[model samples]
Target: MTDTAPASSPAESPRVIALVDDDRNILTTVSIALRSEGFVTRVYSDGETALKALLDNPPDLAVCDIKMPRMDGLQLLQKLRETSALPVIFLTSKDEEPDEALGLAMGADDYIAKPFSQRLLIARIRAILRRSALVRGAPEVENDEQPAEAIRRGRLEMDPLRHQVLWNGQPVSLTVTEFLILEALAARPGVIKSRNQLMDAAYSDDVFVDDRTIDSHIKRLRRKFRSVDPHFGAIETLYGAGYSYSDG
Candidate 1:
């Protein structure tokens, strides 16, 4: 494990990003890139070591590789979710679509295939951090000027400031991406949002996500809501079109 502390003081500290992967080259390369962008980076060679530090002192976000010795990204994410909501982005092989889907289903904020560009990775990191900042109500990073008021749609309720969601009055846990997508739908009940539109709502313009990425997130959203209420069906799919929220 290697830790790089930011030069900034606590009062003006930059965001901290944890990088977990067995490849030393990736650790070195990504850490350097992140540091250059004013981010403090902590790199771990494996998942087990990363998990302990993650729980002991959480970072603003984490980028983890799916395949690793000791524990793997999936296991680390599973354990982390038990206590923390730290934003995570998975690193997967280009051919590993199943793993990407699994990682997203396990609550990853996003995923980037291996051999990724530093610019794309950095863009994704910034995007997730921005969403997280909004959730935490950080004034410096708050891009939206609108009020962070709570929104209620039938049995579903969302508190943007608190980053809280409820179904039938029961709390439901959602990742930053899922929360954004759901919010876009619920904010305009019965309005169908195409995959591209939904992607725009949840991701930064510079970061491109395939249609499957949005589809996986939608499935995860429905699954989470269903876990709270077996009959959960507020999200509707329009064949060959997109998805919409139905409070009625």
Candidate 2:
């Protein structure tokens, strides 16, 4: 007699997320929360092991603890940046605001303070993963048979199809959130976007992030572009009103 089994659907294939922390409790608790949300998790006790494993088999996203034994999160991230562009989110303690800012400045996609809400974390993870999928064209359905072409405003060029950003003809690396915010503003040049509107663009409806989060991302974006082009001042800040892209 032959047995038949139903094939696993695309939705059943859980997205992999790596969790690296020195605390066993955090690892276990976060793993439970992630698994409950239909995400496969890889837990590592230290940055050293996590870095090694991540290089061997990369995950869709990673949540790393800032303070760890031997190899710290910053060190791990710096080393990883040398070879990989994998998205990273740092887990910081309540008193580590400075560290969180530094991490963001150092190219981390995002950060979560200690005593974080599991629901919030899940929402953020989903938001990041969704953006990644959009960039990779991995969405289950084709909503648009004719996708929009790349948008070019001055030296800043955004390619939705290729998920590439060129600043003065040089490649500029941007986080998913940063890219979305820039795209939103640049799509309509000279139009100011409020903090709330920019937040809506960077995150999903389920993710309720602070306005200041958008500010941080904007700062990072500026620093990144300035690194590529010292005179890069395309992103204009309207203080209180929000941000906009300069056409000239």
Candidate 1 residue-wise lDDT, 6-38, digit = tens:
555466678999999999999999998988888
Model 1 alpha-carbon drift over 4 Å, by segment: 8-11, 142-147
User: With candidate 1 superimposed using the best TM-score fit, by how many Å does residue 132's alpha carbon deviate from the native?
Assistant: 1.7
Error of 1 at 145 (Å): 3.9
Candidate 2 lDDT: 0.80
In model 2, the runs with Cα more than 4 Å from the true position are: 1-12, 141-148
Model 2 per-residue lDDT tens digits across residues 2-119: 1112233244567888988999898888888877777778888889988988898898899999999989999898888666668888999989888887777676777888889888
- C-alpha lDDT score of every prediction, in listed order: 0.88, 0.80
